[model samples]
Target: MKLHTPKTLPYIPVAPGALPILGHFAKMKNNQVAFLEETQKKLGPLFWLNAGFGQWTVVVTGEAAHTVMKNKETRSDVMGGEGDRITGHITTDTVSIKDGAPHRRIRGAIQSPFTPKGLTVSEIGALLEETAEKRTSGWKENTKLEILHETSVYALDIIFRMLGVADLDLPLWRKTYNDFVGPWTMIPFNFPGSPRWRSLKARDWMDKEFQKMIDQARATGDTKTMLGAIVHGTDEEGQGLEPKELFANLRILGLAGHETTAATVAWMFIHMGATPELWEEIREEAVAADSPPTSPKDMERFPKIEALFREVLRLYPVINVLTPRRVEEPIEIYGVKIPKDTSVSASLLSLSRDANLYPNPETLSLERWTKQAHRPKPSEAVQFGGGPHFCLGYHLAVFEGVVYTTIAARRLASLGLQPVLQGEIPKPTYMPLTRPPAEAKILLKPNYKA
Candidate 1:
């Protein structure tokens, strides 16, 4: 496959203080948000930065984000050699990552399950309620547990149930998921102990497990779960996903369904812990609803909970930036000409925090979402992104967030427990997806429920 394109418009301008060989890799690893913010401040909305092996043009504004996310010219399929290697090892044929006809076909087959119409609200709510109750109860009142780790486990259970893999080991599945996805943003290192090495091994284990489930689903003609849906699904053309395609796309669903949602749930906890009033609001809403939300459609009934989730996404997008898009032909973003095959991406993190669009952007204002007039304009708070490639599990993720957050908040409140931050706010790991810092612990305080 072709790797190089004709030289792009004089490369997008690089951020200042980029070291010669390593470039901005260190800064990127150290703190991606601050690095991108500083660069955007100095270089304006669209600029380039050296990220170890090469340079990538970063787009920050809604307009530029729209340009890159929507333009079919900037296709969303895999890059040549490296992309092949990564997808080959981890995700072989994910529909969302595909660019052309294959993407559309595969996406069509899988899209139904994620849409509001297809999702079984009772099943989703039951799984989330079960998982949250089981996991949080394990944490004794007033104890501290790493929110990310706990939520990851919770997300895994809910997603696995969605895939009809309810019999799998939760802890092992969670670890494998983490290992496989941890290296997506790491420097390409193939050493025995490297992140890439661990990731590949983890993917192999997880792939075999999913393969077994797929085989069973096909054998049994089980159409209840997503895996069963894909196993027996067809596109408008009556083309079904091939086995390899099935494996890859299922892997994508598993990864995307859980990891990002887990991160969002974790951040929701962090934010709620900091603002007790928000948790109170969520609890009050839950009480008024008379029952916990059980499905994506049911979540619509809980506007306050939905609003809080929206605010959390706006403040801490699980994906700080949309997937990178390589220009197929020359394109102009913010009047700056980016030449053919130039690697480009848009930072959703930056856009969500745009003060011009979201006044007092840094503050966590749940009211901004609840009060119709204060909500961001379309594409302004791009938590799930926009255009053709917006997050496939957008609705499912929101439902999961509302269910998990509402349950957890109520559980804590019932225990007379309040969420309190024990240390400095964690700096998120902003690659692959934005993950909360493990060290940013939350402690439960008793008897402050108002």
Candidate 2:
């Protein structure tokens, strides 16, 4: 499969600035979003880089990315593994690591709760509001809040509740859950009082909790929560997940679903600070509606706010690069020939920032989507991702945003979000995922309910 490129066909080119051993790792670490954008103009979309050692990462953009998403020659197992480092959970058949029929089976079995006709939006909405209230109860006049930390817990609470944790256990569950997943980037050395040690302990706590949820659902024949969906839902062939598959996938849902939604909402809050007028826009979403959205079904009532959120995703995408896909067979795309056994990933940032796909791509304008004629092709924001492996929680994420902002708008009628430093908003960090600065602060004040 390593045949030399035909004289007629060009091999994929390497992006500039590959420092000896570090390759493009150093440059990407500094600012990957900018690096990809700048490189796209100079290198022409698709390029390869050595992250380190002999490992090669192929970066695809535009048409190439769309092709990769829909192609069978690529598989997702190249990125995530059977044992997840981030979650510290291991499962041989987790959907993210499996492909072909097994992947389909696992994905199908768990997908019902997220599907349009199956999810109970009202219940989820009620839970979301309850969680939001507790998380934001600290918000008072001139209160300084770190958007990322708040949104992370807010999103985590929603996920846990959906998986059947009782409201009373939410506070402790959240703390344990955070400790469980927080060691992904830390140095890996197992010792007492270490992050890894805490994570392992957290994992043990999660295992017991998940097993209880599974047992209760199995015993009661209940299908109300996501845990039940995995236990009872069937695939196309009418097969359900095995106990191992069910538990493994259930453990992964929090890690998989929480981050994207949290990062997106956090970015939205940053926008709320930069453009205080948007608060009225958010308020109007709830006001103009016949009634407030008590369920995901009511998201349609808030098109203006929906458009605003879509634009935020485009300008500030939560996914900088889709999980890298490994090429399984030789293929040619976009006039470039890709060899087998190579690591390739689609760049969501490239597609989002493409001027051809979006006019004035850098600017945030709702009309880009709200206006029928101005909407770009492949309309839904690609930030959630594309292809067969597109985000499983895409629908839930969208509805959650609509539900959250509407509730916030109505509750904090006088609330205003202003930069804590009172100047131009800083650029978001873009590695692992795109998110607002951890140190970024906002002043919330005079939010007397109307």
Candidate 3:
């Protein structure tokens, strides 16, 4: 399992502006996309920076990224747990963040529910379509709606319903969800009024809520909802999740499930608004479909819409970087030996836009995915990441995105409405997940229908 490395060069190149102790935290916080791109241009594919705690080596693009993602020695669990502070308080054994055998066992136990076969595509699609209609029903002509907030709320509501908790205090949960994620990228501090403080308070509330649901599901033997499945599921060893493990895993699902999809869907609207011709074609495809994509089989009807969804993920990856890891065992990649405990991350943002892999990388061209000649290699588009730890919810996210966007697009067209950008387009916030700014608006404008 050893990778060959150059005898002379032991470590990767370090990017400039290493401040005492704090490192490049300030620069990254200011504008992550710009900073990473700039550094890559200067330092080539792989470079290191100290994000305050320790030096982190980032694989920007090309073979280096593939090398890092494929290497099993670069274990994911060493950095932070799937739920971080929130879920960590409950248990660190959630499948999403675990490495090695434990990860396999937990993943095996939890994986079935998310598999393509396990999901009832038509049922999920129908539910999402209904949700989308309700969300868009209130929109009026010429009104400005913040795309991120609107999409976030829409996604949150749909996910809650899918979790079989639609009756929960959604408004309160929404507030809590925001607070829980608010401090993800901020420096950890727990004083009153701080993001960390508020997040902890939010986590406390959520922990209790999920625990109650778990207890109820166990008591009632309700195997219908996701929680019910997990509560009842067992691994290859016939071992079930402990109460803490179950609670933590559920929290991971709650946070990771909703936020990333919400961000991507918000960006999808922005891309659609920016490209009207493509939007029209997609809408027409949705309208001309044999029937709305109630099932995965029916999804084949909108190939163009599916292509557009892939393009959106490439351009704006919600989880820009997979969870970075502290290399517990030394690993060599790109002729450099990464020492033990050195933080290493594969930059999905950089890899998706590599000109070598994607021609005219900056352009939002759906043809790259649609056209056989232009499509990237499997390794190039690591938007959901690579290796054994690739996003568990990848399929579900795509299904939800395609189902929600296709139906929503048709509805918008029927109402003689189209998305129009309001003011200057705001840059995405670079947090644990990339999100469009809160003020990012898409106005519903009257479009003269043919």
lDDT of 2 by residue, 46-103 (tens): 7775544334677888867876776488876664443444322443457876778888
* Candidate 2 segments exceeding 4 Å error: 1-11, 16-26, 50-55, 82-92, 183-198, 373-379, 414-422, 446-450
Model 3, residue pairs in steric clash: 122-294
Position 412, candidate 3: lDDT? 80
lDDT of each: 0.71, 0.71, 0.70
Per-residue lDDT tens digits for candidate 3, residues 105-183, read: 7777777667666566225676777877777777777878788888888778766666666545777788887787664
Number of the top-ranking candidate, with TM-score as the measure = 1
The digit string of per-residue lDDT tens for model 1 on 1-450 reads 332322344455657767766767677667777777888888788776655455444554555777788756687653422455534465456666677788779887877777766678225567667777777765546788688877877777877767766545766776777787775525566778787888878877877988888889879988766677778778888888887778777776767777788888888888777776776777778667666787776776688877777777777777776667777878777777776666677788787888887899888776676677643344544778777777788877887888877777677766777788777667877555677876778888884744
Off by over 4 Å in 3: 1-11, 17-22, 52-55, 58-60, 81-91, 184-186, 373-381
> What are the candidates' C-alpha RMSDs?
2.9, 3.9, 4.0
Candidate 3: count of backbone clashes, pairs at least 3 residues apart or interchain: 1
Q: After superposition, how far is residue 206 of candidate 3 from its true place, in Å?
A: 2.0
